[model samples]
Structure formats: C-alpha cells, structure tokens
Target chain A: MSEDITLSLDDAQALSLDVLQHNGFSRAHAEAITRSVMAAQRDECHSHGLYRLIGCVHTALNGGIDTQTEPEIVDKAPSVVIADARQGCSLLAFEKGSALLVEKAKRTGIAALGITHCFHFSALWPEVEALSSQGVVAIAMTPTHAFVAPAGGQRPLLGTNPIAFSWPRPDGTPYTFDFATSEVARGEIELHRRAGKTIPDHWAMDANGEPTTDPTAALAGAMRTFGGYKGSALSTMIELLAGPLIGEVLGHETQAAGPESTAKPFHGELIIALSPHVFLGQDCDHHLQHAETLFEQILGQGARLPSQRRYEARQRSLCDGVTIPQALYEEIRRLGSR
Target chain B: MSEDITLSLDDAQALSLDVLQHNGFSRAHAEAITRSVMAAQRDECHSHGLYRLIGCVHTALNGGIDTQTEPEIVDKAPSVVIADARQGCSLLAFEKGSALLVEKAKRTGIAALGITHCFHFSALWPEVEALSSQGVVAIAMTPTHAFVAPAGGQRPLLGTNPIAFSWPRPDGTPYTFDFATSEVARGEIELHRRAGKTIPDHWAMDANGEPTTDPTAALAGAMRTFGGYKGSALSTMIELLAGPLIGEVLGHETQAAGPESTAKPFHGELIIALSPHVFLGQDCDHHLQHAETLFEQILGQGARLPSQRRYEARQRSLCDGVTIPQALYEEIRRLGSR
Candidate 1:
C-alpha cells in the first residue's frame, strides 16, 4: 500500500463527519466535532486531526457517551452561561453556549461558560481562537484523566491539564497558545519506548519517586509536569476550576467513569471571555497598537511566537490541501462503512 | 550589630506604617501598603516583608509615584471595575476596588478588576488570598519590568510576570499558589553570585542566547522563563491581559517610566473573581466537599500542596512572632527618623 494520500480540506471534513455519524453520533454532534477535526487538520496538528477519529468512534461505541441527547444551554447568571452536555461530547455544548458567552462578555466586560457532563478529546485552541475571532480575549481550560503526577511525587495524581489563551488582534490571526501542563505528551514517552530509546530525565519519574530516563519505567510510573512545581501548581488550578467550581468530575473520577483504558475522558471545560472594549473603553485601539509594538520587538529579537507554525501550516493547507497516512485513511474508511 | 531581631506582628505593622508615612506617603496609602507587608511577614515571606520597606521608601521619593493622589474607582460595566491609581502604589488601588469586585462576582458569577498606572512591589498572593477570604475563587496577575526573555530569545523582552490563584474552602485557609513565570527569581541568581557559586543551567541564558551556569554571566544576560516555551507563552498572556487589555503600560514601558535602577516598577495588575454560588447554585456545598476530597488525595500521596509550607510558617509566626535582621531594622528606623 502507498504510505500517504492527499485530501482537500472539504474531503477531510466529510470523512470525519461520515465516520462519526456511522459510529452512532447524531448529525448535530458529528458536525460540531467535524469542525474541530477540520481545524486541527488545517493547522497540521496531526495527533488531534484525522488520528482522533478512531478514538471518537471507539468512545461512541463503547465509552458510554450520550450521543443522541442534545446539550441544554442555560443562562445561569448575568455573566455566566452553562451548557449541560448530558454526557455527550463537549464540542456541541461549546458550540451551543459560546454565542451567549460572547454576548455576555461584551455586555458585562467579562463572562464565563461551563460545559458540564462532557467527553473532551480535542485541543482547546480551536475554542479560544474562535472566541478571539469575535474580538474578545479568551482563556479556556479543562481537566483530563489522571496520567501525570504532581511534582515531588511518583504516583499519578494530576491530569495532563491544558490551558489555552487567545488575544484578538486588530488585524490578522489572534495571538494564541494552547499547551498541556505535562512536561511532554504521553505519546512522546510511548514512542521512545517503541524505539528502545531513553526518555529525558525531566519527562517522568519511576514508581519509587525517583527521576528515571528509561521509557519503560516512565510508562509504568507517571509523567512529570512542565516547569517542575510551577507547572504542577497550574495543573492543580485547572483541576479545581474546571472540575469542582463548575460541578464536574475530577480527573480520577473521569477516568473511573469511562470504559477501561478509554481514550475519551468524561470531564468538563471552563472558558472565560473578557472584552477589551469594556476594559479600555474608547482607548482600545491605542492599547492594541502597543501590543503590536511588543510583537514587533519579540520577532525582531529572533524569537518565535506561539501558534506561528500553526498559522503558517493553515495557510499552506488552504492552498495545497493536507496529507495523511494511507493506512489511517483505509482504517477510517473501514470504520465508516455500514 | 546583632544578626537578628524578633518583633511581634503588631510592631512589624507599626514599623512599616511609620516608614511609609515618614517618607511622604499619605496615611491612606501607607495603611493599605502596610497590610500587605504585615501579611507577608506573618506568612514568613521575609523577602516581601519588612525588607521591602527600604525599597518602598526609595521609590516613593525617587520613582515618580504619586503619593498624595488617591485611586479613583470606576464601575466601567456590570462586571468590571477599574481603579486608576493616579500613579500611586497598586495596594491602595486594589484595596479600594476589591470590595466592589467581590460584590460583582457574587452578583454576576464572574468579574474583573483592573488597577492602572500603579507601582507594584508586593507579591500577588496577598491579593488573590484576600479575594478567597471573601468566599470567591480568585486569580491575579501582573507584568513587571522586562528582565526575562522569551524562551527562544536572548535579550530581555518579557517580565518575570507572576500569576496567583486561590480557591476558597469551607473552613480554614484557602488553597493558594503564587509563582513567577520565570524559572527562578532574579534574587536567586544574585544570591548565587554573592556566595561565589554557579547558577543552575536552566536559570538563565548568556548574551549570545546560549545556556550559561555562571552567576555573573547570567546576571548580565536574561533570565529564562519556567518550562521553556510554555512559560514564555504564559508570560506573554500576562503581558497582554494586564498590560494592553487594561489600557496600561507593558513591561518595558513600566521600566522606562520608573527611575533608572529603581527597585519599584510602574505597571498594571488584573484580578479576576468567580463565584461558586452562581455556577453550582444550591449545590455549591456539595462541590466544595468534592474539592476537599481532591485535597485529601493530594495530601495522602505525600505530595505537598502549594501553600502548605507557607501555612506552617504562618502558624509558627503567629505563636512565636517573626525574626528579622537587626541591621535592617536599624536602617528602617534611621530612614523613619525626623
């Protein structure tokens, strides 16, 4: 078989939607999820792109997601919105709730959205970037299944919690960043194990709470958080804010509630939006220009900004389409066939 | 001189207040700043405690802060409050705006406070911890003078921007964490230099953008942010949110506005407050219990929480007072003399 194949962006969306619908997801759920999948593909985020379809299908068939139910949007407070996912994937809930969230932020200067009873399986950048496109600063975070450990401990007590932030620019794409709090992704360690290579000492600790370079020992033990204790603190903050504050499951509970070794974890997400118009009032333009100057200095100093590569890939994908492994394409086509 | 002297908490507050008032600060500003100094001393955060008094006095006299002008509070929107500090210290601005910020959060579910044109010298934990004491989950961040570089760059373009988070518990002190985005404080490297020791490899970079372990070289170059690119991204987020979003100066601008080689930096601070009552409604108590369970698990695994050591020090300080250097006490007293 050929190693690779090329598909236009439209075809990628169609394939994802078909695979999701064939696995019993409703059209609304499938479309919402397909939008995120398309975005990941366009940005060249391979792990979150076509590769995620298999996990979505597996979770829909075996992980107990309520795909048939629609998310219920509620105006919880003057500046708060809640989208109860009713145990479904979070994309649809975010889609349903984010409009009201943007309006409330515009009206009240700041607002929050809580997506409860959700199964989250995508990177958070798409949601934050979408909010920024509407001219507001957005911060989004969620707690995943416990796979990483707190600093100074070997056991898995913390999630690879991710936090995303986006700032709307006067022109062009928003300044955006989304990253996992873990030192490295779980797949990185797995790849090293498969290659029979030693993992970096900072990546994980052995079962005895000692830092180890062996990939196998790291896999048996736990992943370490980025930036040592500072990253650990941030991961904990996400667990508390996205988990308890919004009446959602913690990382360990999310892991236990789903199928054994399930790729999709039942969790919650919290997104906060702030309007620059409200904060700066008439001087919003002046402040935004100052931001441009800061960006100029950063680039002038030969430093790359976050999401720069993603944006470049997005431009390339828009012009030339995306390429994926032929084996993955066949596997997805097989899953989609009724 | 004796190496150390012990003072009761009241004496610490009185000394701080006296020093500020003697150095041309209004009683209002002095009192507000003293509370934070007292809290730092009580928590055994010696660096931010009485030791900061000299710098405060120096900045008040030479750093161009408007000591006589009071902060003007504005209710910009339903959920936004701004305290234009009139070029004064941020403590007074934060003190004036916090009550309204807490009220707005409770009423609307989420709220933000912006302190503009202020000289900030205290740790952010005090502000977030104060909000948590008022039964709200709080997050605070501020941009300091540009002394650190982005992860991939060599020259300084970003601040050692600090972020602090706090969650209220049903009883006792709140769960709080405050840390700079930098790998380590600039003072850490300076201390290594004074002790004639090499700094850590991750602490900073030389002028050529290469990693350096020599303390003098690191001091002459740029401090590295914690966690490489992720920390750099977070620092940038702070620069945008607290700087431009609030219509205030960025890190380099803050440094330029203050006296050359001055210890204090003129900047802006942003604090966000969220209410559990609004999100979980009547089920707030149930969710808080879940948070306690998470805390229990973290403690059970012998992994310490972020503020555990500070709380322990707080207890000891409350029982046995606080210890400081006799030389520093004499210096402060001399500065306060008529």
Candidate 2:
C-alpha cells in the first residue's frame, strides 16, 4: 500500500461532514449524509464511498437534491403507507420510510411503504440490512436514470433499477443481496474510465446495437441487461413499481426534466417489511435457527454467507485503518479544504 | 400445422373441463383447473400446459395433495390478507388470493396477500396477465421443491422459485414477464428426456458438483441458477420472502420429514397488487398511455413487447391448431383408456 496517509472512521466521517457543511448543508443533514458514505466505506463498498462525494455535492449545489428537507407521510392504512419525500436526500427519505414500515409491520405483521420524489440513496444493501438486523425481512427497489437497454433494443430505455432483499440469521448477521438489473452499472463504467481500461463487449452496446468494448463508447451507448430478456423484464417491473405506482414520473431523466421538479432526483422507492413472529407463531426463532443450520449443512465447511466476505473485510479495516488511493484522498481533502 | 385436431378456445376449455370432471372433480373446481391449464396452451406456454396433468393426478392420489379442498382466508386487513390453502390446488388458491388482493387494492389503492400450503400452480404469467388486463399492477412469487443449487454449493437448497410481474399497456396488451430462477427448469429436463437428447453442461451439476450434460444426471443433481450468484441470491430471497416469512416451512423434503412440518412440496407465495390511481391521481390512464408512447418512441418500429412473441404464437395456434407429439398423445390416450 502507498504510504501517504490513513484516517480513522471517526476522522473520515468528520472530514466528510465538514465538506457537506461547507457546501451549504445543515449540520444534521451533513452528518446524515456523511454517516451513510462512511458506512459504505466501512462495509468495503468503495464504489459508494467517498468516491461518490463529488457527484452528490454537485447534485446538492445544482439544485438536483435538497439537503435539509424531510420526508412526510402522506397516507397510512393497515399494511400500507405512502410518503412524500419533499425534495429530501434519499438517505433521509429511506431511513424514515424504513422505520415507519418496521413500525407498521410490528402491528400488522407485514407492511409496505411507497416513497416518492427522493434523491439517490447510495448502495441499497445497507438499508435492507438495517431492517433485517431489526428482526424483519425487507425488500426494496428504486427506479433510476435510464442507463440500460431493454432486450433486443439498441438504445437505452430503462434504468439500472437495483433491487435489494435481506433476512436476519440467528447470529444477528443479515443475509443481504442487492444488485442492479444491468449487466454492468454506471459506477463500474466510471471505474473503468478512471483506470483507462476497456470493458467486456457483452456489457454494453453501441448506438446501432452492436457490441462495444470502449468504456467511453459503452457509457455513450447503453448497458445490456444482466441475462438478456429476463433482466430487461425485471427493469421494466421496477419502473412500473417505483414510478407510476408511487406517483413519480417514469424515466429518470424525464422526472428531472423541468426546473419545477423538486430538487430531489424524482426517483421512487418501495419497501416491504415482514415480521417472522407473526408467521412462525411461537417457533419463529427456532425456525430461523433450523433454517440456518440446514443452509450450513448443505453448504459444508468451505461455504460462505452472501455478505460474510464484505463483513470480514469490514472487520479487518476496523482493526487496521482503511486504505484509500492517494488520488481519492487528496480529492476529498481538497473538497474539505475548499 | 397439424391435421389431427383443431379446437377453438371454447372447445379446448370444454374438453379440458370434461376430462377433469371425468376424473372426479366437481364441475366448478374442474373448470377452474382446466381454465388455468388451457390458458397456458392458449398463451403458447406449452411447457406448463396439459403436460402437467400427470403430475397433478399423481399428487392427488398419493395423499400428497388434496384436490377437494378449498382455500380459506385466515386473516384480513385493509391492505393485506393471509390465505391458508388447506392442501388445496394452487389454481383455486391463487385465483382466490389474487381476486381478494385486487378487490382490496381497488379500495385501498395497494394491497398484498400471503398464500401458504398450496399445491403447484402451473404457469405464473396467466394470473399476472389477468391482473394487468384489469389495470392492476401485479407481482407474484412462489417457493417450491428444491431444484436449484445455491451459488458455490454442491447440493440444491433452493427451488426454481419463479417470479412474475405485469403491467397493462394503453394498447390493451399486457406487458408480462415470467421465468424460473434456474438457468433452466425441470420442464426442459423432461423435454430432453423425451427426445433422448443430452442437456447443456451449464444447465446443471451432478451431486458431486461436476457439470454434466446427461438428462438423467441433471435430474439426479441440481439445476444451476440463472447468471450464477445473481439468480441464486434471488432464489434465496424468494425462499425468505415467499416461504419462511409467510408461515410456510422452507427447504426441500420438509413434507417427507413429517406432518408437523409446514413444508408442502409446493408451498408459499407472496403477491402484491397496486392500482395506478393510488398514486397517479386522475392522470393514471394518461400516464399509462404516455408510457406506451414513450416505449414506442424509444423502440421506434423494431422494438417488441416482452411477451409479444408468445402472444403471437398463441394467435397462430388458434388459426392453425397446435401440434402435439405423436408419442405423448398416444401415451395420454392409453392412460385415458385405462
């Protein structure tokens, strides 16, 4: 590793919070935003870490997102709740919406929350993992900017539209799975761009629907769905579920087309939370334990839980300081110094 | 085009219903079961058509399933309901559950239902398509017997767990998608078995975790998940969301373990139903129209809806009767004679 410098988690959070605050965010809002970024870094999801600060800062400054706004609950029923994000950062909106859904599930055994008009929430796994850690099963989806092409199409028409689902294991660790429906995400394109590298041809298509390997060409063109038509169909479902169903506009760019649109990114989200206790009656915990045991039995010794690798990376980083590239750290210091 | 037999939609439905009734089902139950099966053939989903009859019949006779039972609504709230299938056919359970969800969605604008202890329901698309036709956005998932191996695992720990989602287009056609989470399903295995053909290596792994192309070996082993880890993660989500979270026992062979286990062969389902008007206000229909227009504009003349090919095939089958394999047809006739 390069011997430039390293920051503790606390120091990283403080530096990030200062940058957001200097960029005109309230202290509370800045802390919330910084905490989420730090959490991603701690969990080893570097793509969503400090590397994304510039984009988020630009979004806040360009009026594409509001830093101080809060989400408001618009409607509530036995098992459903609707929230208007009111131009807030999606981290705030998602945290609030998830809490409400958990509360509702506690009462009704299951709950669904629809959130509209929010900015992008970095990395979906953390949100679902938070719910799962609270002893609830959670599923979430959000519509995004159009970057992926539908099956058999040449042009981009659907967003990556990532989905996340998680359930708690008896050991308190959550089995979390989150992914974009595209063959590759825009973040990976940015990574390749930074490295001056080419991508696999199947990852994207040029304007005429021919395969392309150049990262620049792929970014200008369209990303393919993960597994052809199946992934394309899933992206369409996310659009329907997160857009029109949540009263948000379809198509990510169209949602942000006008100045009158909320500073929020105009994306929508749906979260479902379920309580196992209601289903398993007196044997909920035992059932989960048995399920995990069976999973281990089938997997044997060498097997790993889905999130275990990331979790171990996080533990190691906590003991030894996290390593950040000199360029990325210098960029963050420059932003804070500004 | 086959010269053997030609049946209109009505005639096909009548014959199927007659066959079920002759096998001792009540007329209403027979009609429901027949309608589901024939609709699969009508929609060009031949894999789920009359070919599933033998399995269903055997299940009924082996005390493995109850053919005469009816679904019971176990719990109801404004936005959610739970239904117990009472070992009943999933055809009845799914239809009843979907109807209830749609009804609740009409009232509350969004609704969800959990269905448990149900028999196998053939062809998930037809149900979602029906909901979409009624202008309700729908998503459905079901957990079944273990047929898929988890990512990096030697043994199968998950069912194919097909998921379906649908939305209505302004042009009066429903955009529907349905697929099993496996790289290939058991139906494909059976198809290759009937043809005395070798399977693809990537489609399955033997019990020892080695890829194989023999149909019999594939059956003895496990189907691989679609796109490896992504599909396996989805299968895990389905198990947690549709099975364990909904009061059904998870894992394969739970039924064989004992009556105390809630694990039926084909068990849990979770369905979500939504009315666009819930969020879109008065412009809901307009939004759908706009979506259709946007999709058309993006695709121009060459783009096709996801299910358009299947629908076209069904129309062609109506005009020119569907072909049936001579050997399979002879086998069916012999069974009937017995």
Model 1: per-residue lDDT, tens digit, B170-227? 9888999999999998888988999999987889988777789998898778999999
TM-score of each: 0.97, 0.91
Candidate 2 per-residue C-alpha lDDT over B1-338 given as tens digits, one digit per residue, 9 for 90 to 100: 43344456775566566556555556656777887888787766767766556556655555667667778886555566778878777777777777777777776666678887777658788878878887888888887777778888867778888999888887757878888888877889978988999998999988788899998888888888887677888877777777766767675644422245543465778887777766566878777776665467445736667777888887887787555555544544443423
- The residue-level lDDT of candidate 1 at A214 comes to 97
Per-candidate fnat, comma-separated: 0.91, 0.30
What's the CA RMSD of model 2 in angstroms?
A: 3.6
- Judging by DockQ against the true structure, name the best candidate: 1
Residue A332, model 2, lDDT: 79
**Candidate 2, which segments miss by more than 4 Å at Cα?**
A76-78, A252-265, A301-303, B1-3, B76-78, B254-266, B297-301, B314-338
Per-prediction DockQ comes to 0.89, 0.41
Q: Write the per-residue lDDT of candidate 2 for residues A1-338, one digit (tens) a residue.
A: 56545678888787788888888776766776777888788877888887778777777777787777767876556566777777776776666667777877766666778887777758888888888888888888887877788888888778888988888888756788888999877879878978999899999987777899888888888898887777877888877777766667665454442346553456778887778776666878777875675457445824556777788878977987566788788887777754
Per-residue lDDT of A72 in model 1: 97
Which regions of candidate 1 are displaced past 4 Å? A256-264, B256-264
Provide the lowest-lDDT 10-residue window in model 1 chain B. B256-265
